[model samples]
Target: MDELTLRIYPSVRAAAPDLETPGLAGYAFARHAWLQAWADTFGAQAHIEPAIVVMAGVRIQMVLPLGITRRNGLRTLEFLGGIVTDYNAPAIDPDFARSLDATAVQALWRRITAALPSHDVVCLTRMPVTLDPPEGAVGERVPNPLALLPGVNAAGQARSVTFPDRYEALTGTLRPRFWADTQRCRRRLAEVGPIAFVVADDDAGMRALIVSLKRMKSRRWRETHSKDWFAVPAFSDFYDAMARIDLPEGRIHGSSLNVSGTAVAAHLGLVYRSRFYLLLIGWEADGWRRFSTGRLMTETLLRQAFDEGLRVFDFTVGEEAYKDDWANALMPLVRYDEAITARGRFATVLMTARDRLRARATQVAWLRRIVRWLAGRPLA
Candidate 1:
């Protein structure tokens, strides 16, 4: 194996030249504006630092924007975006990525692992296995090359919709049941009022939709007994800042599904290259459940995106049933956990055991109920 030069930057601003990496810019999550927003917004509290790695002076082999925090008295390292960031792999150039064999990849990991600043354990979640573009598309297809890194398949996988040139062809390719269901959903929604789909025309419009999405998500979380992530001021602020970013290649995009004159559903996502990353989506809670407003909004957004010539609608991460019904492809994402110290090793064992238990809990309803119950207070 040839020796490779590794350079580490303390922050994204310090990693300017490497962030301009050619060939990989379009799909590189580290280069996305949202990342920088996340770093600055959550920087102080999270101790987030950009650990972007550049190889041989000019080539960006991998970029890991990381954050260091103390967990149970042991310093732990994790991806900056936490659970919200769907894909978390080092952005290696596609050509360089495809050429890597086991020995080369192992060597690469050695260099990356050695550079971390005194952390007990490192956890990078939602790392995609492949970087391949849609089939017949102009971009490259990476077949989960990063899975070669030491990691395990995560409990939940990512999902995406590969659109055809036309909307009719796209729906025609769906399962008959899904296609029929989609048609019925839209028809029923249309009967309630004049259906209108609108994309945010300005910053104010985008901010308004995002605020509405947060409210909708909070209500949903309460029903499921799940923590509302957007409740964090910094997280919501990071998203609001991302929505206002203006760039020629891409910027955060917001859209709404309106019934007559009211917004029944709102979505805020990123538009990069020719792909649409579906990030946050929510619908009005008042009597809108019967309309299946969220599903209808997704269908409307798909048609709009297809007509606009976007190739992929990435539902980001999660194994949601709705995503399975809508997406034509499944993008597998894995998690990497490594221990560098004795404390780290002990934590790793605990984490692994917890993961195994969680996986099993998903299979048994009584177990899931018990887990949720334990997560709450018994009585006042």
Candidate 2:
């Protein structure tokens, strides 16, 4: 085996040429375009640093889009996309991923870890365990190289719906109740006005829809007393930049469900490698709640996905009830939280305790309600 050489780039743009090489599943989120948008907008605060590995210092092997941040006085290294990027993984060749033995993988991992700059801890989340190949038979699964590293299961499982080659066959796979509800929702929504699903093709339309989605998401977060991530200027800016840019491997796509010529529900998603990644979605807070505009929009998008011959529609990272209702399978993503120093160990302990308490609070209905009320959230 040839020795692998690991190199670190200060920014995603610096690593753009190498990242363009599609690896394994050709994950869109890990591509140069997506991560570069993030780096350009938020890298200054986060200290974005991407790492790549090559054999004999020539052929690209892996791309780890990494960044650094400080929390509770502890400097932590994490994936560049943060929580927005659903799957935090390195892009690797399929053959190399499945062929490497445990010893070889750990050596590569150690080299990558050693190359990382000073940081208290390293945390990578949403690492996929199985990946689909581009030329393999339909539904064939391949081992992911990231799984070789030791890690624990993440809090929430990622869910996705796989579609057949044809639209009718894909629709036929939906559960009877789900299919019936979708039909009913469409009928009710149509009664109010003609419902149309529109794709934002131009940059201006895409930017406007992105802003609308942020507002709608903010409204929902305020209602639920959850942190509004979109409120952060960097996150909003990242999406805004992504909406205008197009990548050869994939591009940001905005779709909307308009009723009576009014945009009721809209989603900004990514189309890559014949797969659709549902990133952000929002619905108008008018009289469309009863009509389930969100659900209708999702259904319409699935139909479009089928029409486009997309093999998968990923809901990304979440444990929402509606996601379970639509997803046929769940993909368990793992998290990597390694302590590199004494301070890191203490920080990791504190973080684990805080996470447990937060999880418990979410489990108790009264506690959650109380917290929401305390946060000034309106509850009916």
Best by the lDDT measure: 2
For residues 1-380, write the lDDT of model 1, one tens digit per residue.
Answer: 25557777777677756665545622536664556666767765576655666665355555556657776566777776665567776555656667788667777777676776778877767777777442244655665555787555564677888887667887887799877876787788888899998888887787778878888888888878988878888777777777776544666779999989789999988777777888888888767887888988888888777887887888988666888778888776787777889988887786677667668999999888876775544211
- The most accurate candidate by TM-score is 2
TM-score of each: 0.86, 0.87
Q: RMSDs, each prediction?
A: 4.0, 4.8
**Candidate 2 Cα RMSD after full superposition onto the native fold (Å):** 4.8
Q: Name the runs in model 1 displaced over 4 angstroms.
A: 1-3, 25-28, 57-61, 132-140, 143-145, 151-155, 175-178, 353-380
Error of 2 at 9 (Å): 1.2
lDDT of 2 by residue, 1-380 (tens): 44666677776777788777744454777777887777778775665554444342356766667767776677778877875677877676666666777677777778777777788887777778776664343545666766777655555578998876566666677788888988898888788888788899987778778877888888888888999888898877888888876676667789788877788889998888777888888887766688888888888888788778787899988777888777877888777778989988987786776556557778898767655554532211
CA lDDT of each candidate?
A: 0.72, 0.75
- The TM-score of predicted model 2 comes to 0.87
